[model samples]
Target: LDAFLDAEDVLKVEGRLSRSSFPNSFKHPTVIPPGHHVTNLIIAHYHETVKHQGKGFTINEIRSDGYWICGLSRAVATHIRHCVTCRRVRRPVESQRMSDLPVERAEPTRPFTYCGMECFGPFWTKQGRKQEKRYGLLLTCFCSRAIHIEMLEDLSTDTFINGLICFIALRGAELDMNRLNVFLTEKQCDFVMNAPHASHAGGVWERQIRTVRSVLNATLLLSPDHCATMAIVNSRPLTADALDGHNRLEPLTPNHLITMKSTPALPPPGKFEREDLYGRKRWRQVQYLTEQFGSRWKREYLHSITTRQCWHSTKRNLQVGDIVM
Candidate 1:
């Protein structure tokens, strides 16, 4: 590489190459400069540290006595320390507590489940406007960690019941719905029982929603629409350290969670095979959807419609005779 650079006249030579035998005005070919040599040496040292140490070392460690070569200087050291890949791989200092005690347990018989809804908003398309607010409900079986997502429009009793009914019908063959011991949700009256299955409470689902909010806020930086959509759409389907009781879960995309149920559950022995299996499943789903629905399914199913309702009656319902106030 050095020879090629020299041949191509890319590298500029500086300093004296050799001393002449006779006293002549002609200067000898210049040798490589100290600064350039030092730069190369420092870069080499950085590479060696990264290669041998496995985990990267700091600038101070590179400059320490045994590893230090004569050519390396503070300036060159600083340059190598700013290397982008090295910076990415470097371990940050542990500034916070490493561990904490577990919180007190709730009643054991209370089965874990996640219940929430998401709105599929208007996505930009070549044709025209699309459905901006298709309210959808999600029911997650916490123990089995299965998810069911269904799209709906209004949040009325009929809409909620229809969505739940569709979900139950889909899972009827696979899951024993009666075995579902608890239903969880936030204080949404739809989730809280008005008539049948009157025991349903919002507590568990409320807590789960809070947890989803917290995780999304912490990871995605709390952009409202993205975070809310992600929290509902990506529940329990994907494995995560946060959800799986691990230190750091892999970041999951919404598409991954949505399409997981359509794929097979067999575990591959190796990472390569697992990835290949996932890819095959994804391609197959795309093919099946395309063949079954044709190309215009997006156009047909995703039309935009809006509605407005008054909240006067809703507000009046809250006005009651109070013991205090």
Candidate 2:
């Protein structure tokens, strides 16, 4: 260390670059002490000078400006580790572990007992040489994953009420128009409204809307009609494909729960295989198919949802009095 210092009373590094054309600061930089508050402040100044860059850039800036602190890299690193601006700009986003499934999602219940509702599309149809816009209202069963779709003439309240009434008539409901309290009492149901502008709260139906749009887009090339579109969407598989050489039973679908059918597609014409038949009686065959569906659904669908796809690790979430951008 003494060999590198100048003979002057003031301390500076007698670097070998004296003969070079470099600046005087680079030739003999000022030597600063390790672990000093002033050294840290100088590092921090250079840190901001480089716009809060990483350690390597900040160290280069400090050395280029004529200061040579002992253990410079370690000092810069320590200062930046606790730097508020650096943390705010570079820290990973806060996330908590994925939440548990609600009772409506986890429990096996009657189809449509607990359901999500959403409106999508403005499909155009021609009637009497004029084109009219139509919208679809979707009600998805929270348990069975089955869906019921209704087409609305317009977004008007009366039009929506009529469509809703049609849905209730087919799926079932009650009516009481006189008193608000009486209506609420007679309904025996709760309407949960998600917070305004918080669409994440309706993720269930929101995701379903994407699925519906995908199916609609694919089928539009084949048939522009929405009725057929609904049929195709409702027939989509509820579970991932389970087909294998050993497993002959088809993948379960929403149609199985809604209509007790394997698929909306007609079965291919062929002689009935012995393995396909459950019993001699017709009712026995129906009961057997239902039981098969129930068992497969419980084993496959329930298991699939048990594990979180993302956000598996828990992290500290924002608390009260926390500052955010």
Candidate 3:
């Protein structure tokens, strides 16, 4: 009944239009409201249905179907193109703009390198009601991509120098330390001028710090533990690839992803014969061991052990007149 009545009303309107000699062009199977055109209808339908439904359709897709007409005047097309919402939602088709300066290629002999240092943490320690902060240091050699990390209670001048000394002593053996022509850092005053070596200022290390922070955050989000964080970081391809630039590099962690032959263990020192126990003989043995094993031994063992002792000796030791707080 309601449908029949609606049909009857539409027919009556159609008949009245015919008798009144209304424009034949306006007589269509469906009569849209006054002031509403096909374009408006299509635009409304696109926004309400297609865009709202989370499906993306191009302007051409809308026009190819009868839903939108392709024969719209240039003015109309331009207006639609200028629509702020549509412009915002559209994916840009043009390539990004290039810098005004010409791109310079790296020198044939020079290749990119990366280095990083760890700033120690547990950033705060509670004492009574107060907290103490500590930070660790890390440095990396770009060409070799070898890394050195240190822990320090503060970023004082002396601490910086000491940390850097340990770093250089451990990792600088392979390089002609004189060949370290340039150092790049993220605008850190300590890292920039802590040493007399060449240094360059840039945000590269800062950006790297952010990336590391993100990695750590994501890792901790899954499992908040040092082991888990390190595992996740070491599992990444970038970590191994970054470290491989060093000549004598080994995996940064205890676990190895690939199997390989193991090197033979060094023989223990032979018993000191009377002749061998002489000062010159002992001195030669010490020199030989230092030359052969100093770098690796420092990296693997001495660094951590000595750092703890150094901290204790410097700060924990009390003097005769020292005020014990």
* C-alpha TM-scores of all predictions: 0.24, 0.75, 0.29
* Candidate models: Cα lDDT each: 0.37, 0.72, 0.37
The TM-score leader among the candidates is: 2
Find the 10 residues in a row with the least total lDDT in model 3. 102-111
In model 2, the worst 10-residue window by lDDT is: 261-270
Tens digit of per-residue lDDT, candidate 3, span 132-214: 76454644333222233454568765675566556555434222111122221221222223232322132223433444456
After superposition on all CA atoms, how large is the RMSD of candidate 3? 19.8
Off by over 4 Å in 2: 1-11, 14-19, 33-37, 52-55, 69-92, 123-128, 153-158, 173-186, 195-201, 219-224, 244-247, 260-286
Off by over 4 Å in 3: 1-68, 71-114, 117-122, 125-131, 143-145, 154-162, 173-325
lDDT at position 179, candidate 3: 18
What C-alpha lDDT does candidate 2 achieve relative to the native structure? Answer: 0.72
**Residue lDDT tens for model 1, 188-291:** 22232324442223332344445444544454322234434444545433322234545743333323423444433232233332234457576654444433
- Candidate 1 clashes between residue pairs 3 or more apart in a chain or in different chains: 122-132, 185-202, 241-249
